[model samples]
Target chain A: MMQQERTKVILGVIGADCHAVGNKILEHVITAAGYEVVNLGVLVPQEDFVNAAIETDAKAILVASLYGHGEIDCRGLRGRCEEAGIGDILLYVGGNLVVGKTDFHEVKEKFLEMGYNRVYEPGVLLERVIEDLQQDLQERGLSRD
Target chain B: MELKNKKWTHDQFYAIRGEVLNQWPTGAAVDFAEAVKYHENIPAKKHFAKQLVKAKKNGRTLTQPRAGVALINEHINLLNFLRTEGEADLLPTTIDSYTRQNQYAEAENGIEESKRAGRSLLNGFPAVNHGVAGVRKVIESVNGPLQVRHGTPDARLLGEITLAGGYTAYEGGGISYNIPYAKSVSLEKTIYDWQYCDRLVGIYAEHGIEINREPFGPLTGTLVPPSVSHAVAIIEGILAAEQGVKNITLGYGQCGNLFQDIAAIKALEQLAEEYLNNHGYPDCVLTTVFHQWMGGFPQDEAKAFGVISWGAAAAALAKATKVIVKTPHEALGIPTKEANAQGLKTTRQLINMLADQPFPLSIEVQSEIDIIKAETRCILDKVYELGNGDFAQGTVAAFAAGVLDVPFAPSRYTLNKILPARDNHGAVRLFDIGNLPFTQDIIDFHQAKMNERAKAEGRNASFQMVIDDIYAISKGRLVGRPH
Candidate 1:
């Protein structure tokens, strides 16, 4: 029997963040759930994500920032994605996203306004992410076999 | 370069010293002959190795806290406060991140900015930027013995400046510092660089100044198995002994399981001694340091103290030579001095109360120690075999082949094959053993433990357990039970 092609996803820690544990865990969880994850490890630039998304035609880009500098690192990232011609690609951001104890609702609203399709708080289980990914990919008509 | 576990000749070390001392302008201030004379003048009470030996002899667990600031006077004042208010038996000059990365110009700017702002903008003291004289001023002002603590992959320059300035103990190792701290640094390069740091300590030992050399034992402190850490600690201990370091302190981070934590310290001390003795370093005086929990803490201060006190209790019961204290403001960024003192006093209270009490060698702890020793032996034997009996080469090869993998490390060199999750009783067990050179019985033990937890949770043994365990402590529980 011919093997089915795996759905591709782009994942990395954004900006100067060097928190690789969560990023690596996310990659393992996502890949095990049957996606081909191009994990650009820690300290990744914004362009690298867009470039990888473009190069692999990834269905989604998962951005993680744990250094509490995600706000500054993630600014204008949506615009960069749009400029790179993958404007509609699903974007998910998570982790200790802000510098201090900000309300999760406020943080989520801010990321949504900045073009992320989903924003998760720190400690959100990866299984929940897989479920979200399944539903979102289905809604976008990018479902896998 | 073909790296061997051989000691560097005096000529080779001196040849490299010239280049190392030329790396920054501060390095020029390091006058070895003059530095030796200054070290000789440091009071016996302020000697780190001497204090550790005395503590070990008396069966006391000394307390130490990690503290540092940008400016010299402020740093000295902070150390004095910790010594007096916190009752910290040992003080640390934690190096700033820029200095750890060897960015002296950036660290210099941080110093200027901190001075103008009347506060430290840097996370730690920039000892290299301060040079030997600045370090000496802080050293002279502090009452207790001082240690230079930082997670630097290349600490050659920092070692030179700090040692010349009279700091008696230095922390970090090639494998320990690089695997956990750096994202892209190769193990070979770090192990090679750290050899220089160890050799510098060796030179001090040769001069009858027994500066303590500690291998940072908690590699990627996130749920690391005791065996993995023990293996790395033993390798580093052997490596340091080979370089002529006489006083060595191997350390372990608390794993949250009281029995396992105590057993880890015991196993580490025993394994380190065995490895060092077998490797022909019988004269080396070995000591053990237990680091308080290195994972995420509850944001609430009250809850944070609970975590700190638990660590303190474990350290005390384990009879660690010293316990590295953690502040109550761990979850928050850069704790205030008051909170730091509170953490220390809380720890000291526990240590004092538990001092006369003895922890019985229960079967649980003894079994944990036995298993850890067995697992550590497997890894070390593989490492020795891989290096064709050379630990330095074996360490690099072990990481390359995934035989000695650290869980959740940032380094690209680590295969990232292993996954760790706490068992039903909160003991760390490998959910996925990866390529760790474990025998079938060992693998079966971990698999059985993981299966037991899976059965209890009504869930299959999966990666979710790993994720849950990572956030367990912050959420106020040892095991991440499903709600």
Candidate 2:
């Protein structure tokens, strides 16, 4: 009998936000779903995510920002990834991305242009992210069995 | 900050106004003189301050719901539905996340995107992005008076546009808005920004147009002991009064214990009045608002309604001037307009039924009131002493010294030392006092209450109790017990 390997990912809330409750919930859900999660806790900076992804040989970096400062904190992450020679690493950002009520499309587009692989609305279900990550890994030939 | 409690002089206020009004394009449209004229022409029934006074005089408790949408027409439709179907006596235009953070550019895009999407892209109404004319459209569409509700640390521009657009009431305070909502905003900066907001209200009052100001009372809203909330409310009330605010409502979130909830309302009203009178603002009118449980809600809609109905009962018996309704969809996320209306209608039914009966003044209730008052006095006395009679300066220092700690608040300025847990009856009592300026008697009183619960549960008071109590409501229990 053969078992599939669990995909490892780094998760955290970006910038000066300390919304620990949601971060903890996500950690619990992902771990229970058979994924390896390295949660950096809240108030994480760009370098922290980059270093952790490289250290763990992680496939993705999932960023959550609840304090509406995602635009400022998420900027230049793609550039930082390029500089760190890990630009191919998948980046996903979500949760109250901008301060006001902007269309999630525009938010997603802006983040995608800035190098994020996927962007989510504030209440987007974690299950969607899980499904997408599995598909992305399969497409990239990174899935283990 | 020298605690400039006096109303801002014309030079002081207008000087700041120039910069604040230039923050967004809409700010340029706020003509104060024109806005004052518009407010004067509004019918008395459509004025928030007038309606509140009438409710107080008529001895009726009003109900209000928090609802907002991104698009203009949808927002008006949602509010009208809440007004007619929900039976809300007062209406609110909760601001969107972008506007709350002063990101109007993104809010503008949100408005356009909401139009394209045929649904609200923003959670709340973006009044600032909508500008004065746009907000006036919302005002004209709704029948009842409207208030702006947002968790904004800096509401200077929002205050300018919303008030100019004829909103007669506003909710938030420097301390309440910043500590609970944002992790990194400086308290001193928020306090200064709010001073501008109060002064704007002051100018309106000077022109004989009154606006109602409410200080966000349930800081962090998780098991906040009454005294801690009361102290913050009184401080904010005093700050508003100094800026010529004539009508103020201090609010409290429901704590689930009937006796303690009722006692908190009673004590809040008394303390606000006493503090206002002593501070030489005797003419300032006072009222109370009870927020439905501000902590987590049970996911089951039926169970959520149970929580909602219980809050309505508490608000009615406590005689809060008004009750802020909570929806059945609360735990799920932003509720649909229908769900919001249902919550309001349910509250209306409960309050209407409970109106005829008087709140029972049991000995136990009186004892709760006494304990709340004593605890509040101990904190305020220390606050006053720390300020050396300067309340504002003392407030800054108190937060610095942890004398005014709010549980679970993200502000670094807070001492974060105090911890709260449920008593045997499910009332919130201090678990860890931190650096609160409580007398030995007050400390002993809280200790004994916790011990009662501890003894019953056969566990020593510890941080686990605090964590358990935080999630207790969502798990369908008031007191978290070990499984």
lDDT values for all models: 0.88, 0.86
Q: Give the CA lDDT, 0 to 100, for residue A26 in model 1.
A: 82
- Candidates' TM-scores? 0.87, 0.85
**iRMSD per prediction, in order:** 4.0, 6.0
Q: Against the true structure, what is model 1's DockQ?
A: 0.21
Q: For model 1, which pairs clash?
A: none
Error of 1 at B430 (Å): 1.3
Worst 10 residues of 1 chain B by lDDT: B328-337
lDDT of 2 by residue, A1-145 (tens): 2223677889988865656556756776777767899988766789999999898888889999875557667889889988998989888888767644456788788898998898887556678988888888888988653
Clashing pairs in 2: A99-B97, A99-B98, A100-B98
Q: Over 4 Å off in model 2, which ranges?
A: A1-145, B1-3
Q: Candidate 1 falls in which docking quality class?
A: incorrect
